[model samples]
Target: MFSGKLFLMFVATAMAQKDLSVDCGDDEWVTVRWRPELGFSQELDSSRALLGNCPPSRPASEDSLFFRVFLRDCGFIQQVTAGRVSYSNTLIYDPQPERAFISQPVQCVYDLSVGEEEPEETFSMEIMNPDFSGPAQSLRFRLGSSIPIRAVVEPRSRRPLRIYLESCEFATDANISRAAQVHPIIANAGCLMGSKAGNSSFLPRRRPDEMRLYLEAVWFAVGEQVFLHCVLEACAVQSLPVVRKACQFVPEHHRWVLLDDPSQSYACTCCDSSCLRTTDASVDGVSARKVLGPLVIVAEDPQGDASLDSQSSAGLSEAPVWLLVFAVVLVLMVCMSVLAVSYYLCFWRGGRLGYRPSRDLLTKY
Candidate 1:
């Protein structure tokens, strides 16, 4: 009976150890997923293995264990397992500095034990040169982790000449879409330059002799969807002499600025107040008319145009003073003519009845 009890105890312990489970947190969490082949390589005081994965378990005093995090889309591998992960540390295959861009390989070393019941700890990784060149991308965390992380990438701000072409011509849906796609994309991506000038009261209102244009490209990435907003502006023109002097030496060529946002997962909104300007123009012999490019006005429905026409007709319903006067005069002239005809008929009937002028002739006969 004593032998049987000892055997039962051993079986229970084995079962409990085999029943390990790991919760990788939630869907919104960001994690680095690793492949089995690329194991971590760093010196660790204690081995901290992911709770429910292969490689079974590491020794308690192994100092360090190997683990790997593979970025499927970015084609990079990050080795993170239990040691100091700093920005100064270089990634094996990455040429850019650490933290320069998202999805780049990263390594983190932490002091923890594989036998620890709970695996919960916060780690900080510094990203150097956050501005990276590449297509827009995102990082999704694996399950069983806590602590949410949010990232936003803004384009480097620059002073560029921005011009907003406003006109009424882009009233159609097709036109608006075309203009939105063509004008902003091409112009914003094109080359341009700009400079800031101090405020001046006597600055010339006339057009400049030479203008430099700068283009800014904005990318709005909300989840899987992405949209672009482009801004074109003139730069290098300033009202202050000092600013002008400084700007004079800078190149007048166009520059492109790119921005990225990941929180907006579906639709992209480009609300740039700088691009709103009077779209009307008056050219030689022609009167000022609203210029509508290919872009349609998104603020109102197509039916609104008919409503505007109705309102215009309503405004014209009020007759002018001269028109009213002419109408009154016409009525008066018709009434006068009718009265004169009645008076003439009465006189003619009375003369016939009286027969006075013929009486002297009858007396002579």
Candidate 2:
């Protein structure tokens, strides 16, 4: 009975061991296991930096490495209908190649119709890192609906490489009503806002219209991997009234932009009083003053010399046309005289000038 109990204990230990182990490249790779009570935790060994082979004196088991945890779609709404909301958590990792290693998925459903009562069921999971020898890992989460979801990293490193959240692709149609509030949070966190909306005004105009918020982050490295966090909130704005305001980023030099929907457009104009004006003459209800400058001087083409003024000036400044005609006639007269002299010498005086008569002429005589 004692031996049997020992064997059973060993079997339980083996089963528990199976649940935790580092999933290295190979099947036997050591995995660290955690109980549900541990929640989220991570540790890194400062001496064993992963950058170069500055080998640590510790054994392979003691070697520590830094790692990042990415919860894909951690906070997201899968579906919404009739005051019911459903969401699921997706795990993402920077060091761990497998998504399953992080934690099993948890799903939560909420029904607002329950009237301020607690959710009927809440699903949750804890994330933890057993290794304590590497750099601190970064964590990112999105709150509210406005984009670029806000992110926070623990034990912020001085001049630490900026970590990015990647994976989530923002859709233009996704809820952004929550995005406006979220932008202020992200800006306060020292991160630049990336946008799928080509124009900034595409962001929610009214504080309430902002709803859908998708978030991802990237390390400051120009082309580093970005981890996607979660879609925060999604809401409908189809019933909201369209609001038009001049886009704040539009340049002062540009003419008034034609807006198909006046309620949806806003003008961002220069502060100068003369820079912007609205006139009833415009097809749209707005018109701007036409800014005029000096006329540009264009160089005349040298080949276009056909002006009467040029012709008259050139005639008075140079030789007359009649002199040129007389010179040409005199040269023709000299050429004709020389030709007549040569012809007379060659044929008219052949007998007297020691030129022989042809035999044909002698036979004819």
Candidate 3:
């Protein structure tokens, strides 16, 4: 009988808990509303709630607590189960140690095939020289040469868009299949994995439509035809949240900087660790996969260049000797011919004079 009374009290207290609703309506922000009994605002600790690591928006109405959290913000976590992606976070309404009241966990799921279908020509990736003026003329490059790769998103509408490279991999084949070997250059949501040894990073944005990745050609895949495969996000510039970022490690300072906005460098701190990966099929944005290929990293061969120079030098040196020999032979041949002609002319003139004198004496007799 005593247990029955306790169960009734438990049910009563549970019924008295405030009503809350989590709204994952759009891609950028999650809106959470908690409706409490009138005059109960004093009982809630707004800061203790972790809808996003940010504070809640001003109360639109006096009876409800309103929160506007960016999807990438707060302590929201993402999980992938059986190929489906979802993000979840908990909201604590009451912060009291023992008497805390927490809202039901909020989750936003996105189907991989739900986003806008990207056109074939909408996204492209190409390798460029250091100047980035045009695509690299040749795929062969010596180790340590600067290889600038650009990923572009041509606008389909007047709405301004921003492109961010989420990850990139180097592989031998254009299509990076699961069986194919791949080296991740940029992964974990923009961490430059190659920066530990070389300067590989996403460059600061010159325009919102295109993003450039600066990679130093390394001997990692020398003598092999390598390709770059990248996964990028195209988001509406107007509704962009703090989540859209490109980061690179600065070796000089041993730190990371956000290429798009250095003032928000704190966002890049996650490069040292792991950054949350979120995939959403929203009308505001879409993800694209692009490939740039057939790049050959040629090992520098100083001996080969030296051998060519030596061969040219030897040919030049032998040419002068052959010309000298030919000039000497020609001079001797010309002197011999002149001497033979002079002997023939002198002999003919002597014979003619003797014959003329004999004929004149016989005629006179």
Candidate 4:
């Protein structure tokens, strides 16, 4: 009798626990994203799946993040046996760091269905140069500034890549002169000079990957125009030969900086305010605009701070009042000359037969 009673009790408990609708995954409990494309399909082939065919015991992925406590909530976790009705499952996975696999706790539920897969992936590479207003996509630096160069490769391809930043002046004449030196890769990778003032090569100090490579400061003289060009190239690796084919990038003339040696008199021609990077408080230097070609040094006048040359603003404030007067007088003289010519041509009486008296054409009264 005792054994029979125990069997009956077990059957009743399972019936009570069969209320799975209350235990379903929802936004309140777990992060949920409906994957419509994954409908009617088991995510893990009944073996690697997180739900159906799971082991009797659950192992924690990291720091014992698995759940053991049962709470009174909606939607019971149901193991899929078979059926298209159980389609449009929810997919949940921990977003991992670069080149890392998702933990085993990735969750999928039959809550949502997407007709299509996620949007097509896009690849991009960019140098976070200093942004100082306007369209020029430039980097502003002081003479002794060492900006940390970094690149972000999305969708985490295991392919190895390298970034190059070199002093490149991409003029048609320069391209012809250094045609042999120009690497078919970068606009002129082979022609990469150290700095405008001539210094060490701009190669990364160590083997650099996706991580930010903190380089030693290569000091350039103030007012030197540095046109830094960058190229993203994929390097072949023994482990991933196919990645080389999938990964292809091009050179971009991304950064143009006109370095400001604080000792130089005139403020930056393009930069409006002091520039700053994320960790620039400990580093010295302010933001400035990039000037192209030879640096124009403007001597500061004692009367005012201005550039010395035509490009500079030295003569703007120092303009004599007499010059304004002279300009007005010149404009008046031109206008008077135009008026005199118009009057003479319109009213002058030099006809083909000479001036005829008005009375000759007048009707007798």
Which candidate tops lDDT?
Answer: 3
**Which parts of model 4 have CA positions greater than 4 angstroms off?**
1-138, 155-192, 195-208, 211-227, 238-365
Candidate 1 Cα outliers beyond 4 Å, as residue runs:
1-228, 231-318, 348-365
Q: Rank the candidates by lDDT, best first.
A: 3, 4, 2, 1
Any runs in candidate 3 off by more than 4 Å, and if so which?
1-121, 178-180, 238-240, 278-283, 301-365
lDDT of 4 by residue, 175-241 (tens): 1221111112111211223332332223222443332322222333233333322323223223221
Q: Count clashing pairs, candidate 2.
A: 50
lDDT of 2 by residue, 1-365 (tens): 00010111011122234323322111111222222212245333333221111112232233333321111111323443455433332222222323222232223343433343222211111111113222213222112212222222221222211112211222121232211111221110111133322222122222321212222222121122222222221112132232122222233433333122334333322221212222111111100111111111112321234455577777855767898899999999999999888878877977255687789999997
RMSD of 3: 20.7
Candidate 1 lDDT tens digits, 1-365? 00010111111111222222111111111132222222266333222223111111334233323322111111111222343111111112111334221111232222223342221221121111113233213221112111111112111234222122111111112322222122222211111111111110011112422111221212112112122222212223343221111011112322112111112211111121111111111110001111211212222343566777877887747657798899999999999998777666657555343435567777887
lDDT of each residue in 273-344, candidate 3, tens digit only = 767655434435545566777777778852456677888988855566778999999999999999877776
- Per-prediction TM-score to the true structure, in the order listed: 0.21, 0.21, 0.51, 0.21
Better of 3 and 4 by lDDT: 3
Instruction: Tell me the TM-score of model 4.
Output: 0.21
Residue 136, model 1: Cα distance from true site in angstroms? 32
Computed on alpha carbons, the lDDT of every model, listed in order, comes to: 0.23, 0.27, 0.63, 0.27
